[model samples]
Target: MGIAGESVAVVGAGIGGLSLAYQLKKQGKPVTVFEAAAEAGGKIKTLHLDGFELDLGPVSCAETATLKQLLADLHLEQEVIAAKSAVSKRYIFSGGTIHAIEPSPLKLLMHPMLSWSGRLGLLRDVFIKPEAEQTHSDETVAQFVRRHFGEEAHQKLFNPVLNGIYAGDSEALSISSTLAMVKTLAGTYGSVIKGLRAEKGKLNMSRKIIGIKGGFIRVVEALQEELGADLHLATAVKKITPSENGVKLSLHTNEGEQERFFDKVYLALPSYACADLLADIDAQMASALKQIRYPKVWQIYCEAETSDQVFDGFGFLVPAMERKSLLGAICITNLFPDKAPAGKTLFALFCGGDRPYAFEPSVEQAVKEFHSILKPSLLKVLHVQEWSEAIPQFYVGHKKLLQSLKAWEARYPAIFFAGNYVSGVSLGDCVEYGLKINSEKGSVEVR
Candidate 1:
């Protein structure tokens, strides 16, 4: 398919938008990307302070095949760096203590994190049959885990782990939206454990977590270099109007307000922002987009005064049931030695999720609360950052919202949606979805 006269406008310069622009450009399509921020790589911010390299957003990326191919295509394979094996030694906080998450199955069976009964409950998953209704219906992650593994497993094992990833309440998050692959496994095999056992050899369980040597910002820089004049910075799209053959975008630039028309427009923004852009085009579509919710998150980067190491492993997640002020914490220096100078320990503390501490706090208040909860010996705060609407929470009815989005795209063929909110949240998910765009058809099919 050839797109000779057709032109595309991508809003937002996040990974999704940049990757989509790159893919569309490769297909010989005329493309332009508009970014409100001066720099690209939204939510993938990197900083250098106190002689330590810090990543405030995503710390690492899973070495998925799609990501690997993307790096290869960009000739960035040599820049890739793998985290230390010690990063795999994760931990969980429970009962006022941190317990190491053992990787060995035998050691995990006797792991102190769970009681003996809870350990046995995991083994019973192999024999437990998936509920017929649950296989077809959308349910909370807490409900699915409790039914299959038992309450102890749900509380002790899954809750904190899920919180570390989603920063969401297990009782409210939809399994079908967050862990759709796992849900499919259970629904297909009638047992999640059985499904895992059957696909043991086929699964890529040993994939390494990786990052660029310098920072993820290099990715956007590379894309921008290729885009050249096609990339606009510090330009915001104020309004969008649909036309018979294309769309009209009103932009707010440094000079003045301007209007431009495009054959197609791809919104790679947050659901709420997309809602605002499409409000005039279709009230129903805008209403559906408004239904999506995004949670606020505070990520604090701190350097410990003591040279002595903290608990080894990736980090520990605090279960909401524990009623702790912290959502989780990651030992950045422990994961990648190059992140900080030798004899210096750096940690990234995360708070504010679906729990009571969801509101943003002053730097002093956040430091005080963090000290009270973590009790790190003589902690020195390096950076305190907050993302007001950071991660999108895939609530109980997220799947229904996705279906509605699909219908909206069918009705409005020239306006397409692509973002972490529409697909999975991982960088790999966004990149893969971007690569799958059919520029000739002016449509994006997000599976």
Candidate 2:
């Protein structure tokens, strides 16, 4: 294998872009990272407001193998602060109440979240063989779950859980894109339950959620220190031009506009951002990039400090069937005690997903709904934040967009797209994709 470039330029300072820049630098490659924002860490922001430490973005990492290796490589293992065991636990709203989700699927047989018929239907997964055509087909998650686990499970169990991750409706999201592992099990072992039983070791069911010591900002700070001057903060990449020498970046900084050359350029920005950059380069590529969508969400952080107002465990998710304006709530204090004061408990309440019928959630609406879910005597609303362009949606036919991207990259070769739009929408997924980059080849496939 041979390196594609002597110098690499990474656009956007999000987790994905920074990870790529870090990997390229580690390989002894000259790397430059450009971020339009004054600070790095795109979605991994920690808000310190009114004596409360709230994580409006991702609160924990999945502790994947690559993340463990990353911490070791960075020699920042001390930042590996373990969360309370209860942080792994989650609850599902069912029958007008919240029920704790069992750690194992077998336990679902007795879980209150499912009706008698629905509970019994889960057993049938061991025997029912999915349609052969669906093994590799693009299908809606709602159809996939109903096909295997029955309608009740699809509504009560699958909807909220998947919503927590994708912030979109399961009926609209592509099953292969969202629940790929479980879907593959049905195609491979003839039954999802059987596949799970046979592949327990590979699944790593024992892995615990890893919360960073001081939200995710600590990791970004470490990366910033590692990159030093190679990282350009408050610098906007205006235009890109490809030539035989390399790609020239028209960078706009406080110092003024200037052109710089790089052997290659990797885009790790949002889909819309990417589309804007490549609109003139290739109309087909720009069209494909625009096809990807980012849904909006409102994350409201509040706390209840009174003894009678305390809420524990991970948090509860309201199934869409509940028809509530609230989506879910996270017990921030339970997960990271130091993030909240000793007497105070913080919770990140969320609403405003892709449900068209629902009204845009106001702070008042969220507060009332939060009261319905978790009643607290002394409810204090700390802050209300909205990400108009939140998590990327992987709707059905998403794979087609990915294929088109590959085709475009094949034609261009000098530029590649990365980040949450192409990554798996997880702290670990983005980091892993960047870490796996073949700096030797100076290219990494998003798929």
Candidate 3:
């Protein structure tokens, strides 16, 4: 069946699913979105408390072309606001204090965080040569960094930075898949340093970090408005069975279990959720998806009144070697002063990534522990949110799993998959993936 008149069913109402529905609707296809939650915007939830806007998830996003286009398509260009210049001032905690990350190479040479050997190792990156041949083989982020910049650099610089991004271990994450941009730079210019130098101007121009004026939920709200009655809430897909014509979905709703047939079915949930939905239809494929692991994360939003400025910079990251209870803290007020009331500092404390199971403490207990580490004068916890399985880990063999999933998708054209786990985890990646899935002629082949 042709895509224009074909019916499409999208499971999950997250950014990925909603974006896919929007794209399909733009193509004049009959699209319907099913969301298990009462509301849309899965993890992009924002809270308003005491006249302050607190984003429970994803404080900011790196502005990208696709994201810009999405905002334009949603008529949200006027709502965009660039982050303050101070947002670039990130810090790292070491030796019981926070230090600003030096921007200049000369300043880095005398940086307090790095030892003399580590400084020397960083300078060696320019002299390092990239691999001659490109292959499908993958290496851990730690391994890749050590090979090019030396072990000290990996431990001091790469490890903590990557931990903040993935909430994962550098020793387990695939460098080629997780840090594809860095790998591409290394491969293209024969050295990361050389590639960076060549693209310095372009990188600077593209580094604008932005957020919505009200909150990120505005984007979701706009999409929902555009979709109107096509979006369904409080609905879950229990089973998915492929059919000769297309696909059959068994949905569990408030009324009862219902059956629906569509030309194509798109799953925009996490890997495990998708695995469960497709288990009966494709056991092996579901089993492969079950292998993907997602780590637990606890986010604590707090309001503190300090007589003295606690620290400068956007936030500070704690390396695993520090043995601290907290992963890191984002100075939300510092990054965007408008987020909090005057004279009050707001912070979002994060914990429980790749940490020991024993570290899973109650919200109050965790806040008390952070108080000891942070040492703020009057810190009060405003809100706490826990995600049992938060960020997905792009483990060592992730590439092979992706290849297998792609092959399965090719075999069954009626089913499509889109999620953070499938592509990069950034919001931009999800939106871009949704927009790119359909054919150039605005239609997807229906089996």
Candidate 4:
């Protein structure tokens, strides 16, 4: 036993699960992680194909202090490959032209594509106040943005960024679950910017986009290596039975099906998997988990010969209002030049999730559009990876589901749901939340 003679079991070996298990072990807790898949990374996998490296899952992470500290603790600080300056230059396709977002305040004011009204609306947000007695209650993202930044900023700026990240409609996604930081700022200081100012003084909350040197697969490997034999790849937790003493897991492995008892169980599984495993324990819990939605998404990988026509930037995002087959695209070479061959650039175009319909033709159209923008002497569409169930959508009422999870955790001792569906979906979010949840449980100390 690693901590106080307690045997801990973590189900699902994705980043969330792995990070949780890794931290528990670091804190002297004996933990075993079980994954249904043969590999441990989940979506954050790198595919080496055709002399190019492709990141199928999350392309980059927001290098928050939490993540930075974690990486340093894991001895992976030197492995971080900071994005090139181009990463800040994200393009947005609007009105038939791709415009780069200006970072400088002065430059942004004079940005030809940025509507003066949009900038004014954003400035107005600083002086704006919420409705009388407004609380941090559940509200749609669109509503929150529209109320604060006005329709122009919501459409041109906020919505396009959300399109690239969430793929779901801002009108449906919950502000509390999706943009909790800004929401808290608005609720506390009456303005997001004001809240940011107040919080930044209190803590070092700066963050940036980053990727591992080899790929996120390198991250998976590092985590897996750190876990060592404690991580049971291809071992599945078929069922979970919570008892008075602790919790029991019905495990299915290559050898045979066997039952194991643990002092506590942390489930870092997908909502769907959690639904199936918890059906017997509590139908209400399973029903709530099943209600969470994961729409289909497709990632199209293509390579092109470098040319003047090719833009040197992080690529473009098509606002949901634009009706483009492409939700967004990332220029792999710009971020990490080491991932591709010399004189060649790689592009990853995304489509489908939350889109009305995503088919081959749609993907083809996206490729054609990028082919035009990224004019190359030679263009080759290398691979198309389709994730049937991609990012989880946190709807307006997701708060209730979170509250229900909290309630269930309280009712059942030594049982916790620690999955993406329960918190923000970013890699940093999962890692930070995993640590915070367990830390609050009086198991491990959190800094």
Candidate 5:
């Protein structure tokens, strides 16, 4: 059946679902969003305490054209605020010392981040060629980094930086899927250095990171306001039955067992949840979905007694070779002053990606580990304001897995799987992809 004036049901109220709902509503389409959580934003959570705002999920985002266009369409262009341009200054632990790297290539040669011998070792990357062919293979991210840039780059550069972004394990993560763009660049120029320079405009063109004026939650709030009653909170979808023309979803809401029919249905829930929901629909798809693994990460927020001795710039990343359990830390206070009290600095500490066992530790133990690792210049005692899970692991065979998923989407022509687990993990990427999927040609039985 064709989908024109058909009803659409969106499961999950995360950025993807919210953005999709916003786009569908704009088109005057009857779209209803069902969220298991009481609030929207899904993983994009923000916490406020004593005039301080802590973004529990993604703290900042790049100023990409995709994000800019989305903001403009949502009438949120004016809400974008550029963080400190100097915030790009990064520190990495190498040979037992923290050193800052110059943001430019010329300064990179002069930068003390790596030894002369290590810099020479990096030259090998300029001459190395791609595999010259594409084959379906499962390789870890660390393996790819090591093969391309040597061990030092893997431990010191790639591990910490990638960890700070994804809260992921470099060794277990899939290189082809997570770093697809890097592979393309290397294949094109035959040198990452040359390719990065040529493709600078597209990759990090603006090179400036921006955040919402208030926080990421503001986007969710605005999206919810437009949705009004169509957005149902605490509504968990139980079962989905395929029909001749559409599909019927059995939802377990607070009221009672309600059956809703829609011509199109978007399953934007997490991988684990999505797998469970589609178990009976297609067993093979469910099995493949279950194979998608997720990492368990904990975010620790701390406040210094006085800002006088606090660290400057964004924060620092601890290399894996350092044998330190600490992944990295982001200075939230430095990024946004409005997020903390006047006299204190806020630190976003990340832990427990490879070490999920640490998640069972008591808060006191976690804080002890954090203070021992961070050892900020501040002498005053710090307190942990929050510690929560913010982990998402993308293991090997992810891209092929997503392709398999899209193939599975073919089985249920009208039921679409749209979520961070299937595509890009970034908030903007997920949301944008969700809206894009809605605009695609498809129809499934939902009644």
Candidate 6:
């Protein structure tokens, strides 16, 4: 499967695109990546202000083997660094208070996040036979959760945390696709607690849940350097056309319209962007791609250091039932001590996802709203130093929409789709999927 004279064009220089490029280039394929933005890394952008490290998108990567293999292949194992404090634990906001998410099953049973009734509800999952339809249905997460767990679990437990990830309402997100891991756990062990205990032996402990030593974008920079001149920044792909020989692309650059042909094309763009390009190539696929939904969120980063303040732990997630305008608050300082200067903490705030009623105001509005959430507890002077232009959204119906997109790929052998919008939203998952797409043939299917 040497690409030799065959050239592969990657549409976006995000993790997915870079991973594909790296894998293909390794396999003797002539690979070229086109980035619409002035720089690569896509949503994984990092900004430094007043000596504070701000991650506009992802804060950390999960401890997984897929990431280890990917990074090891790129020789970035040494670059990985864990959080400074062992208190790098997630906090869940429930009943107007925050509680650390206990890691162990015994602690989880004692955890205050779930009420006695909720705990009982969790036990029911062990005896409850998984619905036959649920095993393979393409339904929203809300449906599966409400059916299996109950409304309280759906509202209090899954919604907020998932909203933080997808930034879309779980009610509309595909259950089988978005939460495949959970489904696997349920189907296999019939209980999350049992699953963790049984599968712990198969896990690799070396890959810790952390970010890069410098910043997440450092990984992107390293990938760019590895790819060398093969990476093209500030090149926007306008459209992709399927030809009898291969695939033709129309691109927009400062120099003007450019046409390029490739033996294969990997679209690492957003679902909507993919729809736009596929419209001329495959109308049915474009229709299904257009159905994919994405919500919008506004991320605001504030740099505030106070020797007097005592906010501990990684971050806090807000449940929709709380009626708070903020989705959650991450004490970036606790996650990475060096993220901010000494005595100062970096507070990252997220807002606007799933709930339309949630206010999405200016930096002033978001900062002011968050002040109310933190002020009562910390009672400190907080000031926002920076803000992002916009946040991404992974909407409902994304799974079925992907099915249609892949079907189009089946029809067009040389065309493929890979991105956060397609299979996953995590940096690790995106990278893995990109490499998988390159290695596999026929149709692009995620299962």
Q: Which parts of model 5 are misplaced by more than 4 Å?
A: 103-117, 130-138, 305-310, 355-366, 369-389, 438-447
Which prediction has more favorable lDDT, 2 or 6?
Answer: 2
Q: Which pairs, if any, clash in model 2? A: none
Per-residue CA lDDT of model 1 for 1-447, tens digit only, reads 136768889999998899889988988889999998888888888888768888878888888887888788888899888887767888777887777776454676787777888888776556656666354588888888887777777886777877788777788888888887778888877778677778889877778898786778777778778889999999999898888888899999999999999988899998999999988777887887887777778889988653344556777887877766577788777777788888788888887777533444344565665565457678888887888888888888888888878888888877888889986788888898778876556665545
Best by lDDT: 2
For candidate 3, the lDDT comes to 0.80
Winner on lDDT between 1 and 2 is 2
lDDT of each: 0.80, 0.80, 0.80, 0.79, 0.71, 0.70
lDDT string, candidate 3, 256-350, tens digits: 99999998888889999999987887888899898888888888999976556565667878776666657778888877888888878898888
**Candidate 5 weakest ten by summed lDDT:** 379-388
Clashes counted in candidate 5 amount to: 11
Error of 5 at 273 (Å): 0.6
lDDT of 2 by residue, 89-205 (tens): 888867766788875887988987678999987776777665653554788888878777788888888889877887788888888888888877888886888888889889866
**Candidate 5: tens digits of C-alpha lDDT, residues 1-447:** 345577988999988888877777877778999998788988888777667777877888776666677788778988887887558667766665567765564566556776786566566667765553233255787776676667666776778867776767687777766777776776676667777888887875455688786789988888888899999999999888988777899998888899989987888888878888888887887887777666556677777543234466577777555545566777776777767778677777766555323334344554555565455555232334332334456778676777777666677666887777764777767766745653556421111
For each candidate, what TM-score against the reference?
0.92, 0.94, 0.93, 0.90, 0.88, 0.87
Candidate 2 Cα misplacement greater than 4 A, ranges:
1-5, 130-136, 356-359
- Model 6 agreement with the true structure over 1-447: per-residue lDDT tens digits: 334667888888987788778877887778999999999987777777777777767777775666778777777888776765644567777875667775564665556777787666655555545454345455667676766666766777788877677665676666666777666766776665566577888844335578776678887887899899999898899888788878888989989999999889888877667889888867777776665555556677776443444667767787767766677877877777787788776787877666645454355555666665555333232333332322234444555566666666778878888777775777777777755654547234665
Instruction: Write the number of the candidate with greater TM-score, choosing between 1 and 2.
Output: 2
Number of colliding residue pairs in model 1: 0
**Model 1 stretches astray by more than 4 angstroms:** 103-109, 120-124, 130-136, 305-310, 356-376
Q: Which ten residues in a row have the lowest lDDT in candidate 2?
A: 354-363
